[model samples]
Target: MLKNKNLIMIFREIKVGELVDFVNTVFYKNANIVPITPQRAISQANNPYAQPNDVALVLALNNKEEIIGFIGILPGKTMLTDERFFWNTCWWIDPEKGKIAAMPLFYSMLKITKSNLIFFDLTPHTASIVAKMGFMTNSITGTKVFLRFNLNQILPKKYAFLAILKPILKFFDSCLNTMFAKKSAKKELNYQVIKCFDASMEVFLSKFKPTMLTPFDNTFFTWISNYSWLTTQPNEFETAIAKKYYFSYITQSFVVELLKITHQNEFIGIVVVTCRDSEMKIPYCFFDDNATEKVLEAIFNYAYNKKITTITTFHPKIKEQLKLKKNTVLFTKQLVKHVGYPKQFETLGITNKLFQDGEGDAVFT
Candidate 1:
């Protein structure tokens, strides 16, 4: 169909000044890009590490430019601290011009940079088209359930039982694992993880009041709390109040995770992900760059001590900051993934697999 079209589709980079305007015009008819705070947007553009990508365009190969389709592409893992590389409204094209005419411009975009995946977030319209372009659909069993490991919340109040009931619990776990492997017994099985609450977390939430947070809320809370000078105040009460509100927002938005950290103190800086159970058939755990090779050691230690099977959640590796680190209890970065097993997606019922972004839009990134 594009062969018959005469319009010469030319792709080019968008000027920083016009990025917001272009994003608005492109997604206006579909989803929204209006909620991103102006302050956050500017910070990204000014960051030294921010990867460059197309932000706007002068429609058609024209000089006196007017944008018809606006798109933003961001570098994966590495990005400007404040700037978000959007899977923006790249599909924005004039309907009258026809899909055949518009698609070439979209095709031209891959030349700018490669993305791990192009999310057909709003328009399922492009799914078939993009998939045909070589993007493989993930298997239904490949989906994951996001379990937030709230450092202070959801901890089992009864660690004493694990000691006294060790033998009985071990037998129970063995039976449950055996049954869980058989598809026939899977329907009636439930495996609850060991949980331990952080007293500091409980105290902090009580003193402060902030916005509700998702699993990603921990980092964002730290970021947004900087918005006000409250964090710098000398009064512990004032600071605690602000943080309390922030923590409350988190509990309301995301589910608590099922694990406990190796160390419960904050005297040092070591960030690690601990695992206690798996909602899916497999165990899942993640670590940041700072965790270094020590995280592996910690995981092995924990698994050995507990006598449990474990699997590490795969993420692009980063610096290991958790070394002085004994397996410290708090996590500093947001680890995201598709929800549920891929079977749910294959059956076309992957609703719970979706998540709302920090800014309030349901995004699949």
Candidate 2:
């Protein structure tokens, strides 16, 4: 532990013994906050990039040794290029200490990690701060598409236009659905959607070429499925909440759907989707160039069948295709940024790489 005036900073890997208390105090103590359980902590700590006994956290403590702030670290590896990187997630600092206190912790992370560091899904305000802190933002922007629009449900009560426009939006959405159905019908594609992550998925992903996105190889996918914190079993409290609220409650476990496309017993494409509530996000989609439209149509068909109100993607081609449709709504534009060593992406030969919405902790709502 290093002392700075009245405050002390502790840099250490997370330990199994302190995992429970650490998770509760850092993520769950507030009544409004949902706490991470010991199981989730253990899984998150099992990062492939983590050194032995590394907890991937920077804890700020007062003179009394009570935690005042913390920043989470997630280690990841690129599949095709075999490049390793660290993603910074879940940053929080005590309001009483002021934002200035966060600088030391941020600097600590940069000093410690040998691999490149990335920050995903940054708000404009946070992006501005990170830019000033020496992190460079990527030129690539994320894409989102809404398949359904609920004016009154999404808008605040103060907006009278929501109530007035709800019926109109509903009618328009109905017509849009009909148009989508027509488009899907025109494309006679044969594919089967499965909810399993297995060797077959490994085989399919092996054929995929990741340009700018994180590689989804067997090892990475296995890590995501077997060791990701989002895969843990929900505790009793979470189970009760899920039982009571069902569709309304935040999901405790990650939900993934793999669409395996085949025609005449030959593999043609694969689409992997992650879902949170009414939104479905495509993290990986690889198909023959000729099959893009058909694969997209199949994805929409699945989303409509599952009652998903929104379908989003980060692939530039998919975004362009979705934009061509009259009914698709733009949800939000996402920005990704990076810092630390290995700053030159051109040297790494991943200048054209594409990032997806489901990368890092984004898949976990």
Candidate 3:
């Protein structure tokens, strides 16, 4: 336990009861925090990353024993090196306590784990603070690119004039699409996109060579599927070839669409897109170089047909190729940082590995 004159900090694994209480008291009450059901809380408590008898949650309270802030940690292991790391997630501090309150909670997490901490999906403000805290920012950050499918819908009401320009934009966009379209046309191919996972999907994923910062394997995929609230649910009547996908519109603000891409009756890839409001973000895409363009074309067509305003991705290769197409915009660059020994990272030689959006809990959101 660490304490200041006005603040009290405790370092311990969160229990199931406390987890439920926090969800009801803090998450349910706050619009910012995503509410978790009792079952989901139990799943989090028993997650592979959690220490026995404790979910990796750190809490801060005032003299009245009221919860003021918390930091959730998800345990992870490097596939190549098997190095254990705690992924920092859902960090928050009550605005009333001021920014300084975050320091104690962060320091407490470090003290408790005494291991490497990986921070992904950091905003500019949080990135600056973590950099000052002795965390090394990865030189290879994630790239993001956006393609506006429905220009008129994306334009704000105040910029209604932009609606008139939509036709011009679409004309230019079509020209660019034609210029970048694949030259070689094969036989009229049939592509199947479904929401489900089966043994066949697992077999396809096995062939995936993880070139990202995070090592993803069967264990990681299985762990991710357990969060029904955060991820797409399996369809009850799904066949061996197709799995059903479900999302809670009321509770889950975001929807993860897992599309198993197949061509000519063969598994080509899997594309996972998270949709929120008018924007759709591609967090994970597993396909070969040959299928990259095809998969992307399928996604773009789907988005357009669905009237999705924007489609975005953090994959460098995808972003690079999309930039060549008309109306594709480079939105922003995300910085990834870690609180670990420099020598360890150097030894791993994965500092420059490619990072995707769905690499961590970023997919869940």
Candidate 4:
């Protein structure tokens, strides 16, 4: 619907400086728009296997000559829907700037991408405001923390950017892991690998809303948590097509024994981790507080064996506890929040109860 609607539209891939500038303006913070030195960026941008995110339609408003509002979109498969979608992801329109910045920018994006659904993450800070814009809670993706043993040994860029920040993260991951390890002793002692994709869909909603995390697109989140993906899809075409398109987005993380492990998989408690493909780069991994020390030991053991230098985790609690600096680079994939506020989730030929309550969907998505 956003078309030729006013504020002149300019579509282009976000230049690092431009994006950093916009982020600074909207968040009202001072930051350096440092060049992204991560090798991952190059993979998606240059590899044929890469399904790089689309950003050829960024909309920026200029009042006279001053830049005003902007919208950033990251494209992805609609959380649960089949059709391609262009999530309305991120928008920043300073009230004073008026619709000049908002209106045209939106229309321009609609004109460009071939998206059926669009969305934005509904974090605690932006929940109420997004809800007011006709958004509704859809699902809950818990943000968990994982304490790592070595900071410099796990992150990809530890030597470069985090050399100075390593000690802080090391201390943090250590303290939390110790605390969690103690608590694990009292946990229900239910580490039976409960079900190896076993015969159970037992999803126990956490009682203590750790981060007050909630989903704006509940169906999407729920479905993702359920029918998670693997290199193989139910159908051949879908699987082949997916891999062909998403190979880059899909990092080749080690598959258990494929990588080295020091600690045996006894009943150590597991931590929380977010593995979303966009927004932030690294997947989040928070450990069970009681089993934190074991986690660190295992992590260090793995590093030692594989000669792998570093790894990164985005678990908020762990990030804070470890004092890991924000990677500073964010990829905003556009998403359409829940299409309509459903009175009771009126399904329209959309039904997936397969993994209804198992595996937490955290590992698969």
Instruction: Please give the CA lDDT of all the candidate structures.
Output: 0.33, 0.59, 0.57, 0.34
Give the residue spans of candidate 4 off by over 4 A: 1-55, 63-67, 78-82, 92-100, 110-115, 124-136, 141-365
lDDT of 3 by residue, 72-183 (tens): 7666665546656667765777677525558877777776656477677666677777777777655334444444433444553358778778778677656654564332
TM-score of each: 0.32, 0.73, 0.68, 0.36
The worst-scoring run of ten residues by lDDT in candidate 1 lies at 246-255
**lDDT tens digits, residues 20-111, model 4?**
24333532222111111122222213322114445522535342433355554434432244444444445555566535556566555555
Q: Model 2: per-residue lDDT, tens digit, 1-365?
A: 66667656554445434565665563344323232434456666565555544446666665555456666667766643555577776666767752555776777766655536677766666667677766666544555666665343456346766777877767776676565533323245466766565676667666556563576654455455554444235677655434432122334335666788776677777777777656688877777677676677777777766667667776676766776664544254443333222446546665556566666766544
Error of 3 at 250 (Å): 6.2
Mind giving the per-residue lDDT tens digits that candidate 1 earns over 1-365?
A: 12224544444555445554544454322321122222224433442323444343323332223233434443222111222333332345544443443555655555443333234333344655555666534321122222223212222224644465555665665665454421121222122233333454434333222221123324433332222211222354333333422111111121223333233242111222323332111122333334335444444343334333322332223213322333332223333332211122333333322222212212110
Q: Is candidate 2 or candidate 4 better by TM-score?
A: 2
* Ranking of all predicted structures according to TM-score, beginning with the best and ending with the worst: 2, 3, 4, 1
RMSD of each: 17.8, 5.8, 8.4, 14.4
Clashing pairs in 3: 235-244
lDDT top scorer: 2
Question: What value does the lDDT take at residue 187 in candidate 3?
Answer: 43
Model 3 worst lDDT window (10 residues): 238-247
Candidate with the greatest TM-score versus the true structure: 2
Q: TM-score of model 3 relative to the true fold? A: 0.68
How many residue pairs clash per model? 40, 6, 1, 47
